[model samples]
Target: MSPVNTSSSLRPSSFLLMGIPGLEATAQHWISIPLCSMYLLALLGNLLLLAVIQSDPSLHEPMYLFLATLAITDLVLSTSTLPQMLAIFWLGPRSISFHSCMAQMFFIHTFSSVESGILVAMALDRYVAICLPLRHSAILKPSTVARMVLLILLRGLVLIPPFALLLWRLPFCGHRVIPHAYCEHMAVVKLACADTTANTMYGLAVALFVVGLDTLCIALSYTMILRAVFGLPSSQERLKALSTCASHCCVILIFYIPGLFSFLTHRFGHNVPHHIHILLATLYLLVPPMLNPIVYGVKTKQIRIRVVRVFCVRVA
Candidate 1:
């Protein structure tokens, strides 16, 4: 295929984001209603989770600290893309500058990596709490938790630059129209005119290394946790031990299920409708952030009580 406008510049100055493919004409305005509602819920829920964790000293243990980290990650992750998405849906197709698109891509992937790490940390917290009950406090002290959070941030920062750099070196065909609502890494990479073998392989490797490893670690942690729980002396003890993990398990499912589906469909689902892929991609980001706090608030008694008390105090 002959390149369009490639002589002027190797890359376009801005990308035209086409929002959802088929639905952009008629349905996008209606779509914004639920999208806006979900974004607001994500904001409210995660902020409330952070506020509750911060206000109550009693809840400042390793698990809740990890919860706070997850909440903050969720807040940033949703904010990075959703507002722009809303603008596109409510107004029309929008153009994002090359640098701005790259920035959005970095923030989305980096914080997503951070969130996956946080889930592993939460699993570790549960494992330590269940398997090494006496040593849990000593092992996951505030200082240690702080360092872990720092390392999670560092992992994302250190790993994601290569993605942008790899794409930066490639020549675009001057067709700068991105078919999705936001700047997803693979979607943007597909716009390049050159052979994208390196970009594709590197993205796959990173996903497998980061998310794949995190999933393995979480599975191992829960394996040990279940063994320790089942070995308890009484049924009641087993049930109590299992109950502690319920919220984490739910959160993990909600997060990973849709995410993996979206990832797979993006790469492999040639037969799938473009709108379906876009909707799945958008939902994966919004759903987890909206549901995470609710799952914790309902499953964990401490958060539930504090959430109630927080409202009651405000009312009085």
Candidate 2:
């Protein structure tokens, strides 16, 4: 070996991120145009929502506060990956430092977990408002809302560290190319040369235990809300209560359905085309942030009015 060594393996210090597999260079540029547009819409919409909530004193209730928290989470979630993704697509800086890649993965997953928790909090808020209307204000005061936000933040903070650390410890000696746009937890871990059993199992555990539990709780809350809504004496009252939850239900479906599909396909559908997986992952990341604000703006009458008034004032 000392005389004529031909097979020495060296771990790459950096990773090349393929923004989307099977897309040509020109096609990537075309895709970037739409991707950048979505990023702008997400930022503008979330910021506008925040500004409206802040300026309006009447929206100082728990529901609006939770919405504000959701806006902030969506803002972070989109920002966490879009710029780097755009760089990979628009320019050609496809290389990410190992540590930087790890950081990106951490932020992406942490904010995602936070968003899921915020949705659950919103469900609980709606349940209180509809199921226990008389005690809604007493039960969900500003202090309680603040605590809920803190707990949501803590939930992400606690759950993501171990995942990140596990990935960090794995020795990645193979090709340092990520096949997707962003540094998704599983995507990065799959590049490791070491035994990935722990990483795989822990990731599955987080998805099943954390997100699964959140989904279950949200379902229970909504079921109870439905029962209460049905028990209302007047059909109009039931409709009003159900209307309050419409936007939330839409947001929940948008956030979870694509994500679940992407997760399942990533794990099981080895025969699925590479581009399909990448596209689904991209949609999972981009769609919710871009759509949540629109859903709320169109569904919530007060927000719609405020948005219209703001536009009118600006035009005038």
Candidate 3:
């Protein structure tokens, strides 16, 4: 229980991050093994996915461009939290400066927002490719996809600062020990001595709005996709169309289900165990990044072949 620095009573100069509730002293070392492994896999998977997509000229389409954006987002999102999480597990509770904490808070939420938007974009890409095949290239041109990715990044950048800013304006007079793995928005805000109604309401609103809108877009896109697939004259055509979407559907489920669960449980699961909540929160970032490339590499033929070619070339 040490402050990184002393400051005015309004806010401490730094906050101590408890690696994980109830496990910090004993089980953390054991926990770090899997955490570190997942982190390394996530890094390797996403980086390799990017390299594969970039090396193959055939993957330079709108769909692959969106996948590349997603790989980058996954890299940023996982990197934002896992390194610090591993450090805390290895080194015990660590003190983070106020600004550093806020910056972490910003990147974590911002890139999460970006990832959500990217998912929606990918869904739309699939929708266009399936439901409007003839116009797909016309609709999702390279320039258009580039602009879409830029806007998605900008949306996250624009929307997520308010979460950190709202917390910043509040006074933190309580103990600055955050009782979780990283500087989660709600976890850090809970230490504020003043009213956090604004933080709570704003955080809830933004989460619901982004998640809701994105979920609706994905659902609608898939609904149309399903209808179009079924309308195909041949059973083989239907299966072929569905096969193309299977990987994306898997990615969406992994990305959103755990994410929404962790988010809601953090806000409303009053009786849930703290360790479970923290683990879910931590994994919500790690699991998808680790799985995304594997899912795509297995499900997409082009990526699989290129991945083999890349490794074969290196081995030779």
Candidate 4:
């Protein structure tokens, strides 16, 4: 006779997404309050920027177009993770299927790669406008911007699939609880029971080679832009050129500095608390999306004027 099977015989098929590892239930509840506020503010700010750019004919320049694209990317990036994060915080449905986790990881990395590409493109836009003013219009026509956008999408499409496939093939037979607020690629890979050397090396390659190259190109572009701006005869002209680039530079720093911090924390900070790693990683993604619109809206004169008009119209 065979032994009877019972509920205890069932194996686990899902992973528990630990939102901000080491946080108590009460802390999570309190944290969600600020998180929700930031999400709402980011959503409103980005949508308003898109609307202001789209509705104004004067704002149909290449610079504004790039800003609009950045806003769209920020919107999607935050939306991709925030809802599920809040769900875990609110309803306590922290369990996510393996396949679902894979999907989330794909988007998180894809959007991040695309954002890197967009920042490079924005740097080039500024370089052309500031350094090669006579040819800016000819070089960055509407068709050219369209092509750049296409290339941005294609870059992520090509580079991110191998990452997702690598993760999909891994056998995750160990603990199914992820110690983070979201399904970060490296975080998920750590849960795998199989050899993960390839994943680690590939991830490092993308970070160092792919994203690092983009950062280098941006720095070169700005270097040339600064030289050209300083060559101007009038100090006011140089200041204006520098001011125009300040916003982009600020956004670039916001996006990359935390990314570097998180990368370092993950690779070298073995003694650091797990929750600290999770916090830095989450901030690397979160703070930029939340702050990009605010930076642009406050720094760009045209955007600020339009934003005031929007508020006045609403108040009326």
Candidate 5:
């Protein structure tokens, strides 16, 4: 649905501009490059991660399994929007029809929700491994991991569909043009001619339920983890314990903030600078997948070595 300049599917503004999503057209036109570059780099990196994990039998643990799944999700999340997004920006009619736009919105959210929940699960895994060292293997067994993943996937499945359906049921005769590049919930909801009070309210509730709640749970898990790690009077023990999660925390911060900003922008940020909106929107979709592999690899020494080994052998 990402139509570009020549597609005539989107009405052209005679006022010439070149921006992606800024005060003027110039900035919007240019933003697509950096964003696309980030997407490609992230895609390649995660793919390498997947290959490394798959090839190395020694890496087949609950953690590496999770990393592989996360990479797959990242790949889905990035590819879901980027190609169409790039096409819209570079090729032709940047206009997506109503249904197509809604489909994109659902996918972006679905994969995103999955990734968030998975991160929480990972945090819990670390918590158990640290706080219950004796029972770490028993507690984080394959069955337990499977159940956790199943529960979260269903949670996303149940929560998102009706909300998306509710949006589809709405009539869209208002401002047809979305000021933002992607078909985000806030951006798309704003375009609906229908009373969006319910949409906005439930969306906020869900955001609070998912992001806010997930953040809190992850924080608590880390607190317990830190407590366990610090109880070990040895500094080396603490550093090793902390290092595994530090990168994931960084990635989590990157992942959650943009969605929060996007939600805020839709509600309170009407007069927000379009540049900020663009940046947040880009970051929301860009950073998680980009940094996902790096996080897993840093925490996963063998996976890192395997990644290098694969590439170096190819070169040799």
Candidate 6:
């Protein structure tokens, strides 16, 4: 029925995961509706952000360019799964097919990789700006930023596809159902009928190499950036630098801390409540996408101005 990939018979789901009431069904009756509302807001905000960056000549530099690209990636990464996942929360059969599972898993991982790369790039941009203000423009030129993005893209193409394919090659003959909603790597891979030691090892390696490494590097970059900011000649300069980095630091913390905790708790924490687990899973998918535009808008004045300018031009 789907063109995503090779179709197999819908495997009989073994896990109920949720209870008889199917919170997905009763969710509207009790749970907050803002979950879906916020996702839509983020989608719109990111679109406005992209339009702003494209419209404003002032925002053509590497930093905003990367931010715009990050916005697009966030849109795609969240849209890949959230919209359908939301639908399931409101509708019946909150289930995904094998091929659809693979596709979601790939995009989720790919865009996650892209986000980490963009954050590192943003950190580098800040470092250059603070430590070498005189040559910031030359170091972070448009061409260089473009090339960086292109490299991330090429790497994603080369690396992400193989994981998706490898996942497909494994059999899901055991438990047809995944424990969580959607096709998360750890969640779905557990369902595979074939030995999952290889998949689990690959997933763990990727997590450590990609997410772990990114966090460590970003932290280091900020350390240097902070030291440089503190050594600045003027109080005004220090304040400005801190202002610019405040939102980024908050965004980084927001995105990473919960993710690390959730990943760890899910795998190791014992006797976790069903609702809590599901909520963390929901946050993992939703928080970064929703908060990203807000982060950029609040932290970067240029992006805010550009967003207003683009909207005004459209209105005129």
Candidate 5 on 160-262: residue-level lDDT in tens?
A: 8767776755655445667665677876676666578888888888888888889999999998888788899899988988888787787778788787787
lDDT of each: 0.92, 0.86, 0.90, 0.84, 0.75, 0.73
State the weakest 10-residue window (summed lDDT) of model 2: 1-10
Estimate TM-scores for all models: 0.96, 0.94, 0.96, 0.93, 0.88, 0.87
Point out where model 4 deviates above 4 Å: 1-12
**lDDT per residue (tens digit) for residues 197-287 in model 2:** 9988888898897789999999999999999899989999989888999999999999999889878887898998987788778878788
Superposed on all Cα atoms, model 2 deviates from the true structure by an RMSD in Å of 3.5
In the predicted model 2, the residue pairs found to clash are none
Q: Weakest 10 consecutive residues, lDDT, candidate 1?
A: 1-10
Q: What digit string (tens of lDDT, one per residue) describes model 6 on residues 1-316?
A: 5523222333432332321124655663344367777788879888878877887787788788988888888888778877766665666445565666767878887887888788888888888887788999888888899999988776666666667666666655556655565566777666666677777777677778878778888889899998988998999989998998888787788778777876776578768765567667767768887898888897788777766776798899
Which pairs clash in the backbone of model 6?
Answer: none
Ranking by TM-score: 1, 3, 2, 4, 5, 6
lDDT by residue (tens digit), candidate 1, 101-187:
999999999998999999999999999999999999899999999999999999999999999988887788687999999999999
- Which run of 10 residues does model 6 get worst, by summed lDDT? 12-21
- lDDT by residue for model 3 over 86-157, one digit each (tens)? 999999999999999989999888999888999999999999999888999999999999999999889888
- Per-residue lDDT of 306 in model 5: 83
**lDDT-better candidate, 2 vs 3:** 3
Query: Which model is ahead, 2 or 3, in terms of TM-score?
Result: 3
Best-fitting candidate, measured by lDDT? 1
Residue range 193-292, candidate 4, lDDT tens digits? 7689999999899888767899999999999998899899999998999999999999999999888878877778889898777767766767888899
